[model samples]
Target: MKNMEPRIFFKSSRNVAADTGLSKVSLRAGVGAFSLMEMMITVAIIGTLAALCMPAWTKIKDNSMRARDVSNLRGQAMAVLAYAGEHDGVLPGRINRGVAIPSTVTTDSKRTYYLSTVLIDAGYCSKDDKIWKTVCGYGADQFGVAYVVNSGKSSVPTYFFGNRSSTAGATTYDPKRIVSLKSNLDPDKDPKGKDEEPLSQIWMITNADGENYNSSTTGGLSNSLSEDVRTPWGGRHYVYFDAHVEFKRSGEYPSVN
Candidate 1:
C-alpha cells in the first residue's frame, strides 16, 4: 500500500483540466468541453438570429416614425382649424410667395405668413428649430418647413395660406386632389396618383409647374423651391380637409393614394 501511487479525485475531469491550466484535456477518458467548432456554430446561430431580427426591427422603427410624422400633420391641422374658426372659415390666409401675390387675397392686408409661422403664431406648433425640424421624413436630419398645403385651386398667382384649398369648412375640396403633405416631391407638382414610387422612397425631382411656381428652379410655378432639398421616407403623408390624417404608400402629387 505504501508503494501505491497517490491519486486525486475531481468532481469532474473538466475541473481537473481547468486546474491544470492547459488548453486541452490530455488525460484518458477526459471530460468533454466545447471545441472551437462548437463555439463557432454557436456564434453562427446567434448571428443568424440577429440577422433575422434586423428587418423586423427596421419595420417597427419605420412604422413608429411614420406614426410620429402623421401626428405632426394632425397637430398642424388642429391649429389650422383653430385659425379657420376665428376668420370666417378661412385658413391663416396670409402668405408671401417670393414671386407674385394673388388677386383674390391681398398681401396688402398685413404681414407675411408661412406654414410654420402660422402654426407657431397660433401656438399649435413649437418654434421652427424645434417643431418643423424633424428626425423623420425625406432625409433623417432634414429640416425647414416640412409641410405645405393644397393652398391653390388651379395653378395661378395664388401661393399663400388662402391660396391652398380650404382646410375644414372651406367651401369645397377636390376629392381627387391632395391637401397638405410631407415635402417629398415638388409641392408645385399636384399629386394625381400617376406613377408607382419605389417603396419608402420620396421623390427627388420637382414636378411643379414652373409657370405658377416661378423660381430659380424654373419652368414650373415659382422659384421658392430647390432641387430636392433632402430625401424623405418612402411613404407620403396626407392631411385632408376633414382633419383626419391618413398614411398611405408614398406616391406623387394628385393621387394622394
Candidate 2:
C-alpha cells in the first residue's frame, strides 16, 4: 500500500501579485454609505419633533406675560403708600368723580392715582344696616372703602382698601383721612350703572361697578373710568396705595388682603 501524506500549498510572490486586483478593501470602506431613503427618513423625524415642541413653548411665553402683569400691580401699590406717607397720612383725591389725581412724582408718566376713605364713626346706619353688601361682584364687603388708582387710559384699574362703608346718616369716607393702606391690582374695569356710582361713593364702600373694561358708557368722569377700556395690549397698568404697580389682565381684577 502506498503511504498517504498531507501537503500545504503557498503562493509565490508572482502569484500573489497576480491576485491583488481581487482584494476587497475598497468595498469594505464603502459599506457605511446611506441610501437616499434613509437620509430622507431621518430629516422627516427631526422636523416632526420640532413641530411637537412649538405649542408648549408658546404657552410658556403667555404665562410669563401674565406674571409680569401681576408684578406691575404690586409696584403701583407701593408707590401710593409712599405718596400718602409724605402727605400727612391724607390720601390723594381723584381729579374728578372717577378720575385719578395726578401724583407729585413726575416719574409716574403723568398718570393719576385715586384716593378715598371710609369713616368708622357712629350714627351712620342702624344696627340692622350694619351688615355690609358685597361690592363690584366680589363676595361680601370685607373692606369698607375702595380707593381706585387709574394708571393711564389703559384697561383695568388699581384698587386700594380701607374697610367697609358706613350705614346711612353716618359720615361717609373722607379722602383726607387715610392712615394705613392695602391694595389690589384688579384686572377688571370700573363697574357701570344707570346712575353710575360716584368716585366718592365707590370710595365709601365696595360700590365700584363691575370691572367693565369692555363696557360702552359715555359722559362725566365715567369717561375717565372707561379710558382703560379696550386696551390694545389686552391689559392695563395700575399703581396701588401700598406703592406697588402691576399690570392686570383684562376682566380679571386682583384682590388684596
Candidate 3:
C-alpha cells in the first residue's frame, strides 16, 4: 500500500466547545464587566458633572420667570392705558369699584380699591388673568407677594396708584405728581401738568415689598402669619407710562420725574 499522509484535525473558532477552560475565558479580562471601584468612580464623576451644571440651570430658570413677569407687566400696563383712554385721560387711582368718580373731596374719593379689582370691574381684565399674578415670593408663598404696596396697610389693595390726574381739584392718591397721557397733557384734568416729563421717566407699576401670609406654611390666606415680599429672582420688573417694561436689580428702583 502507498504511504498515507497522517491526517490532522483542527477546530474552527466557532466550533470550539464552550465548556473548555480556554474557550470560556475572555481574551481581554474584565472587558465587558465593571469592578466595584470602577463603578464607584463612575458614580462620583457623574455627581461632579451634575453639581457643576446646577447653578447654570438655576440661572436659566430664574431668567425665564423674570421674562414672564416682564411680559405680564406690559400687558397690565396696556390695560391701564386702555382704561384711561375711555375715562377722559384718567388712570385708575383711588377709584372705587362699580361706583362713579367722587365729584368733591369725600370719604369715598379717599377710599382706595385694588388695582386688579378696578381693572376687573371695568371689564378691562378678568380676575383669573395671569397678569394679576407673579411668581416672586419669600418662603413658600408666591402670588401674594407681587402686589404688596405702601407696606401693606389694612383694607388697602397691595398695589400703589399714584395720581395721574384730578377732576375738579378732587383729592387724589399720591397727589405729588401729575401723570400725562402719551405726549398730550390735559391741562383741565391735571392743573399741575406744566412740565411734561418723558413717558419713560414715569413708572406706572412695579413689584413692591410688604407683609403677607405664607400660604404654604400658614396653610391658607386666613392665617395671620406674614412674611417679607420678594421675587424669586434678584430683580423687579417696572412698567413705564409708555407701556414699556424694564427690570431693575434688587435694592434699585425707578426714579420718577
Candidate 4:
C-alpha cells in the first residue's frame, strides 16, 4: 500500500530538474558582480588621477598665453617701423603717432608698448626736468608729465608703457629697465629719488643702445611677459601704423637699429 502512493512522481521530478537548471544559470550570470568596497575603490582611483593632472593643465594654459602675448607685441613693433618709413624715415610724434596705431594708443587693448617723443620737437619736453611734458612722454617717468604738471594734482599716470606716478617732481615708476621677455610676473618697483634718475633709466622701446625697453607694472620688452597682455578671447593681436597686422612673442622681435 505505501509503494502505490510513491508511484505518481515521474513528471513532477522532471519539472523539478528544469527549475534547478535555471537557478544554476542565474547564479552563474551574477558571478562578476562587484562588492560595494570594490566600486568605491575604483571611484577613488579615478578622482586621484584627475587631481594629479590639474596643475599640469594649468601650467600649459599659462605658457600658451605668454606665447600669444609675445607674438602680439612683435607685430606692433613692426607696424611702428613701417609707419616711420612711410613718413620720411621720421618716427611719429606722441599724439599723432599714437593715433596712427590705435591698437597701441588705446587703453582698451589691454596690452601695452612704450612710446617716445624723441622724434618730436624737443621743445615739448620740460627744461627743468628731462621728462617729456607733452600728451606723451619719453620713458615711463615722463609719461603723463604734462598731465601731472598741468593738473597740479598727482594722479596715477598711464602711458603706452603702463601706469606710473610723479611725486614732488620725483618720478616714482617701475624699475625693470627691459621687461623680461620670458615672463611678465616681476614685482613692482617704485621710482627711487627726486632727480627723475630712476625714470630715465627705463626704455620706451627696443633699441640697439638698450633704450627701446620700458618699465611697466607688467614688464616691458623683456622676457618676463605679463598675464594682462592676453586678450579675453586668448592669443595676442596687434595693428601697426602702416595698417599691417602682426603676431609676435619672446623668440621674435624687431631690432632697434
Candidate 5:
C-alpha cells in the first residue's frame, strides 16, 4: 500500500465507486421492474379489493334509489288521501281484480279520471320529471304513482273505492259495491290490485307489466300488470288505506286493507 501512488489509488477508488454505483443501479432497475408473478399478485390484490367494495357500493346505490322511490310514493299517498277526504273518502280511478276504470270526472264524455287528470291535473299531486319522470322512467301519460282498489279478502267483504268522478260524488259508500269487485273478484273486472289485499292499493307497483299497478306509467289505462314485475330493487311500495307507507318485498306484501 505504501508503494502505491496516491493518484493511482484515488483513480482506483473512483472506479470502484462507479462500478459499485452501476451495480446498485442495475439492482434497483431489476427491483423496479416487477416479475410477472409480482404483477399478477398486485393485480389479484386490486381485483379482490374491487370485488369486496362492489357489493357495498351497489347496496348503497340501491338503497339510495329505493329511498327516493319511497319518498315519491309517500307524497303521492298523501295526495291521494287528501283527494279522498275532499271527495267524501273516494280514491280516484276504480280497480276491481283485473278491471281498472279511470275515475269518471265528466259523465257527458266519461273522462276516466287518470292520474294526470285526477290528481296531478286537479293539483292534488305534482309530477315533475325530476320527481317521477326520470325516476319513474315513464312518459307523461304513463308516469307517476298508481291508484288501486280492493278485490276483497277471505276475512273481509269487497270494499268500496273512492271514485272522485264517481256519480256518487261526495257520498260516502253511496255507489253500491259491485260484486265483481270482491273476494272472488272477476279477474276481468278487477284492473289493478293484486291478490294480497281486501281494499285499497300500492303507491307504485314496481315496473310491473306496464299495466295495472304499473305506477311508473300514470296516464293511460291500456294494459295489465306484468306477471313478473314487482318491486325491482327489493319490493313494492304501498301507501295504504290508513295513510301509512311501507316498503314490501315480493310475496310478503303487506295488507292494504
Candidate 6:
C-alpha cells in the first residue's frame, strides 16, 4: 500500500483566506462591531440625554413634594376648624401640654406653650403629623410646626393668641380673655365685625423660611433662618384663615389689608 499520504482533510491556505474574508463580511453585515469613536459617540449621546432629562425630573419631584405639603396643610386646616368649632370658634394654642381651660398655669409649670401645642394636645392633630413638617421649612424636631402660627406679639387683636405667661407657672391664662377668629382688632374704629378684611385675606400659616420667621420675634414659634431663605422653587405655600391654600413665590405675598 502506497504510504497513504497523511489524509489531510484540512482546508488549503487559499480556502482558509476566502473563508476568513467571508466570515468578516458576515460579521460586518450581521452583527457589526463598533469602533472606538462610534462607541464613544453613543456613550456621549446617552449622557447628554440624561443631562437633558435631569431638570424635568427634578421639577416633577419638587412639584410632588409641594402637592403633598399642600394636602397636609389642608388637612391641618380642617383639624384647626374642627377644634375651633368645638371651642366656641376660639382658635387653639393656649397651653403646650394641657387642657386650654382658663388656668393659672405658668411657663415654669409646663413646656413653653406653642401655638401648635394646643392643636396637638386637643387631638386636632398628632405631634407626628406630616403637616407639622415642611419641605422648605425647619424640621418639626426643631419646633412644634414648620409654619409660623403667627407673630403672637400683641394681644390687642393683632392676630392669633399671644403667650401671656413669661415662664412656667408665671402667669394666669384667663379664659374670658380668649379671642376667636372673628375677634375685631379695631372694633372701636370700625363698628363692622368684618374688620374691613375678609378671612381669605388673612394668612394664618406659612412656611417659616418664606416668612423669615425668627424665634426671637415669634417667641420660639419657629426657628430663625439667618442664611438664605429656602423655599420650594423660590416659592412657598400659605394657608389662610378660611382654610384656603396658595403657593406664592418670594416677594409675592398677597396684598392683604
The C-alpha lDDT values of all candidates are: 0.45, 0.36, 0.52, 0.32, 0.46, 0.56
lDDT of residue 255 for candidate 1: 36
Please give the lDDT score at residue 179 for candidate 3.
Answer: 48
lDDT of model 3 at residue 93?
Answer: 62
What lDDT is reached at residue 189 by model 1? 78
TM-score of 5: 0.52
Higher-scoring candidate on lDDT, 3 or 4: 3
What are the clash counts of all predictions, listed in order? 35, 38, 0, 26, 16, 10
Backbone clash total for model 4 is 26
> How do the residues 1-257 of candidate 1 rate in per-residue lDDT, one tens digit apiece?
46987676545756766877754535643446678999999999999999999999999987787677667666666666676666665556445322121121234332234555544546665644443334453432221234445444332223324432225664532211112223233435745443534312421111122222334422243224454443245445656554666554434454321
Rank candidates by TM-score, best first. Answer: 6, 3, 1, 5, 2, 4
Poorly placed runs, candidate 4 (over 4 Å): 1-34, 93-257
Candidates 2 and 4 compared: the better one by TM-score is 2
Largest lDDT belongs to which candidate? 6
For residues 178-234, write the lDDT of model 2, one tens digit per residue.
432222223343342223222322222112232431123212222233333233345
Supply candidate 5's per-residue lDDT for 65: 70
**Best first by lDDT, ranked:** 6, 3, 5, 1, 2, 4
What C-alpha root-mean-square deviation, in Å, does candidate 6 show against the real structure? 7.8
Predicted structure 2, TM vs. truth: 0.36
RMSD of each: 11.4, 15.9, 10.2, 15.8, 9.1, 7.8
lDDT of 3 by residue, 1-257 (tens): 99999885876544554435444357235357899999999999999999999999989988888888788778778877788778766666663211111121134433344566566667887556476555544432232334422211111212134432334785445411224332222233444424556778556666643322344422353322345655666556777777898888766654311
Clashing residue pairs, backbone N/CA/C < 3 A, model 6: 106-168, 106-169, 106-170, 107-167, 107-168, 107-169, 108-167, 108-168, 108-169, 109-168
Worst 10-residue lDDT window for candidate 3 reads 150-159
Best by TM-score: 6
Candidate 6 C-alpha error for residue 172, in Å:
8.5
